[model samples]
Target: MLQIKHFSLRFSLYGKGLEQRDLEVISSLDVDIKAGELVSIIGSSGSGKSLLAHAVLGILPANAHLSGELYYQGQALTKKALEKLRGREIALIPQSVTYLDPTMKVGKQVMGVRHDAADVEAVFRRYKLPASVMDKYPFELSGGMARRILVSAAVIAGAKLIIADEPTPGLSETLAKEALAHLRELADMGCGVMLITHDITLALEVSDRISIFYSGLTLETALRRDFEDGGRSLRHPYTRALWKALPQNDFSPLPGFQPYAGTVTEQCAFFPRCTMATEECLHPIPMRDLRDGKVRCIHAA
Candidate 1:
């Protein structure tokens, strides 16, 4: 239900004396979510996963400049359209609970005030929230409760595309599984869910597809099946490295650091740490369709 093509994001900074420079955080990224699918974006801390969410919701900072086309339900999803759909057709489960209003009662924030009490109560029941939570303030809710509140709001919206950014961090194991099940249920009901997270292992269980992000770009998009047997079924050097780094796999850590934005040359961003890098990797590597998915590596078949 959502498609992003050649999406890029940059931020302009003004140094001393108006000396300006741009930091490119997203570059030539592409992802698609079908009406009944849940796609997970997995990457390291600075991989621009959250930036993609802000760009889609049109909540970028004033200094942020975004390029490329974003589509929703086959229509161009412009900024104005997003403003109308953000809290209704397209909802966000933000990474930080700070997005919650400290002053407003929880029910008002979740149901948006105009919603019927019965509808609000039903959504609460589905998320296992007690009726008493409606009268509580944000401060009264624990971190796990706050996360569930975020999910409950989106479920009530009946959003076609739900961008859940790190929605299960503070949740208990049971509550975390419950949240994932809810998202999966939403997808089964024909809603497109974009689950952005750092937990590839857990994401594998709920997400239909996985898109690996590295240094501001998507290195590969693969099915959950491809993540098995030590990533033998996947492509992209970075992706395999990530799988190996997982405790369930080789437990080997990748060497070298992800370079700061704008410092990347036409050469592959994974070049410095990639043991398989060749001199031919000097040029910009375009994404290629291989097997059943896409990869941004030249050596991948």
Candidate 2:
């Protein structure tokens, strides 16, 4: 069980003083993830998806100023508190598995975290990793093997919550599915999991709920059934465009530019690219309750 209330993190662009122009990243973000529930965060590259992940894990760089209430199992978490929680209660499987130690053997690296050799070995075998590969360093393994190794490390850490950022980014389709299956197993075992990805198809396949982010702001969140049954109940315009772009036995282009950090303004971040934009779009958008979930948009009601 993890919750983020009015979470705000920002990067300073220039001189001191809190001005609208000084904000470079995420504004107010609210998120709630429950135990044994797999939630996926879908958004374009620079939409603060990864930033939210890092902020949750307290891994963001020093220059970034973070202010928010992050709670794990009802316990308030600060940067210092999160540092203690990492590698034990919260594990991060980064976007790149190549970041693992190249000099040490795979078994050594995994055991270094939890110091449980038997558990680490069991995880490796469960992931179908060969016994011979255990002695090899990160550089010696193939891409798929490296990905599995990262997954093994996260599992062996015995963390209560796992934040996986593009866990299957570079793998082939079959391998990607395999990696996701492993994450599904983790969720079934009662670990609160956040799968951060841009692939809606994969997210729909594995997640219990879906949260859509656009321009560093949360757009819509809904049950998996709502997304599959044509997403008719969806409110946000960005979500409508996303559902329209899905390949349905036909390939149609989804035209739009990816959102950037500094491009969006305080007033309706998606207004510039939104086709349904009206004069009301220029005003500050508020989060409207639609009974099923909350959506931030003028037209969501």
Estimate the TM-score of every prediction: 0.96, 0.91
Candidate No. with top lDDT: 1
* TM-score of model 1 (CA atoms): 0.96
Top candidate by TM-score: 1
Candidate 2 C-alpha lDDT tens digits along 30-146:
778888989988887778889998998887877788777899999888868888999888998889976797778888888874477677778889989987777898888888888
Which 10 consecutive residues of model 1 have the lowest summed lDDT?
A: 111-120
List, residue by residue over 1-301, the lDDT tens digit for candidate 1: 8999889899999999989998999987899999999999987788888999988888999999988999999988887898889988999989888899999989888888558778888999987889899999999998778878898898888788999998778778777787788889889989999999998878998999999988888889999989866589889988998889889788999988988656788899899999888998988998888888999998987
User: After superposition, which runs of candidate 1 have C-alpha atoms over 4 Å from their true positions?
Assistant: none
C-alpha lDDT score of every prediction, in listed order: 0.88, 0.81
Clashes of each: 0, 0
How many residue-pair clashes does candidate 2 contain? 0
